[model samples]
Target: MLEYLTSLNDHNLPYPDTIHPIVVHFVIAMVLFGFIWDVLGYFTGKTQLFEVGWWNMFVATIAMFVAIIFGQFEAGLAQPYSVAKSVLNLHTLVGWSLSGIITAITAWRYVIRSRNPQKLPIYYLGAGLILTLIVGVQVYLGDKLVWVYGLHTVPVVEALKDGLLR
Candidate 1:
């Protein structure tokens, strides 16, 4: 088991491709969609939209944790170069923070729903907007890690192996 775990591919991953991004994308979509649904529900007075938004937030809260777990595991295997290290560290911090934020937001949403399922408060909508912006920032940081830093890309891994990148 240890031997198999130690044997990593050219991307410095045990598996073929990164799983963190895949899981994280789901979390991002759910969060963004949830905010949109809540806003629409608030404006149009459609309670069903609130239901949809609640479910999305609920699932997003759960998925965020899963994404964090996979992200931590993949990051441990990333072997990021010096330039990528700072961005990776920031991404890690934000990811963990987002998980907490999402969970808290979901809990707040639950309380709101329990009190009034038909109408969402304006303050909650404001919080949703804030959460969406934070998610956008997180997405940008994540994109930087992959596009600019190329932490787990084939060429980057090869360069690291050849001692080209410090």
Candidate 2:
């Protein structure tokens, strides 16, 4: 049982890079584009774009949850130390928060779509814009974990194995 659980780590994955990032990019793009299309559709009075936005938000909502699950799993196996710990914690916090936020927004979007697919309310767009900003911050936190701290990098892994990080 322990071996099976251990084998679920990022290192044991078939790919060289982690799966979280791959899955996360989809969430990012979909959410961003979803909000964009909604905003554009609202201004342009384009029903077609609203349709696009609704589907995008729908898919993004599902993908964000998938990303969060993989993120939590990968984060558990990260074995972060020292400075990376704070970053990882923050990233995890925001990741979960964003998942909820996105889900809520998607629900709101769904209702708005069902009621009036022709356009979204200004306040909803405002909330989406705010969500976009939060997503930007989340991206920054993720970047710091990978680029600045090298959480799962080969050298960092070697360092951890050698007792260089604690």
Q: Report the lDDT of model 1 for residue 5.
A: 74
Clash number for model 1? 0
lDDT of 2 by residue, 1-166 (tens): 6666445334533346688999999999998999899888889888789888889989989998889888887787778888899989999999989989999999998898888777678999899899999999999999999999887788887788789989
Provide the TM-score for each candidate, comma-separated: 0.97, 0.91
Top of the candidates by TM-score: 1
lDDT tens digits, residues 51-164, model 1? 999999999999999999989999998888899999999999999999989999999999999998998999998999999999999999999999999988999999999999
Q: What does the lDDT read for residue 14 in candidate 2?
A: 33
Please list the residue runs of candidate 1 whose C-alpha ends up more than 4 Å from where it truly belongs after superposition: 1-3
lDDT score, candidate 2, position 166 = 94
* Model 1 TM-score, 2 decimals: 0.97
Clashes of each: 0, 0
Error of 1 at 89 (Å): 0.8
